[model samples]
Target: MKLREIAHSRTGDKGNISNISLIAYDMNDYEKLKQAVTAEKVKAYFSDIVKGDVVRYELPNIGALNFVMYSALGGGVTRTLAHDMHGKGLSAALMNMDI
Candidate 1:
């Protein structure tokens, strides 16, 4: 099962840092996401692009997981020559993860 089936993601970027928020559509699926999704997994999944550490913050009250990835934007939007400088596609890529 793909993560997208149960949740959706939103991404934000600042400097070389990228933050992805995974929010479950149904509250019941939150636990399942928590069990399967981890900072390590996310870090590994985006290893090619992310150059630093991945940190996950659980927001049980909102049934969401927030991942902070460092050194992920090449060198931030202002400096990176990549087409998707904002790293928004990363959220969609993360949705492809198996749950």
Candidate 2:
């Protein structure tokens, strides 16, 4: 399913990179989601599509997951098209992940 299917996103722009803050909703079922999502899990969730790295930041207080995926936007603003960069296709790709 898409990230939107499981969690809500707070998207922000920074230089060429985008920061996507994720909070799992009731739709994800906390216990199941806790077991399902992790740093390694998030990385695996994005392994193929992401070219650079996926950094995970856990928020215990909020019970949420944040991943800062880099170099996925065709070099962000540095690219010729200067495309959407900040992970243009990420939402769809992340949503497709099984877990």
Candidate 3:
């Protein structure tokens, strides 16, 4: 199953970094998410776009996982010629990950 089936995501950006938060639809699935989604996996998944380190922060109390992707915004929104400068579509792209 895709991650989207069990969780939803929100995206934010600052300079060349992208912050993606994945929240489980049900608290019971939080464990599954933690086990399946890792910083290494996310870095590999977005290898084409993410040029720096990927860090994962667990939010067990909120049933969510936050990923901080460095050098992901093509040198920030103002300078990037990329269509999705704000990296909004990144959340949607992440949702497609297989769980």
Q: What is the number of backbone collisions in each predicted candidate, taken in the order shown? A: 0, 3, 0
Full-model lDDT, candidate 2:
0.60
Q: What TM-score would candidate 1 get against the native?
A: 0.95
Please write out the lDDT profile of model 1 over residues 1-99, one tens digit for every residue: 999999998899999999999999999999999999999999999999999999999999989999999999989979988878575888989999987
- In terms of lDDT, model 3 sits at 0.93
Encode model 3's per-residue lDDT on 1-99: one tens digit a residue: 999999999899999999999999999999999999999999999999999999999999999999999999889988899898575789899999998
From the highest lDDT down, the ranking of the candidates is 3, 1, 2
Which pairs in model 1 have colliding backbones?
none
| Candidate 2 residue-wise lDDT, 79-98, digit = tens | 62744445545654555667
- Worst window of 10 by summed lDDT in candidate 2: 80-89
Give the C-alpha lDDT of model 1: 0.93
Q: Local distance difference test, per candidate? A: 0.93, 0.60, 0.93
User: For model 1, what is the error of residue 81's alpha carbon versus the real structure, in angstroms, after optimal superposition?
Assistant: 1.8
**Top-scoring candidate (TM-score):** 3
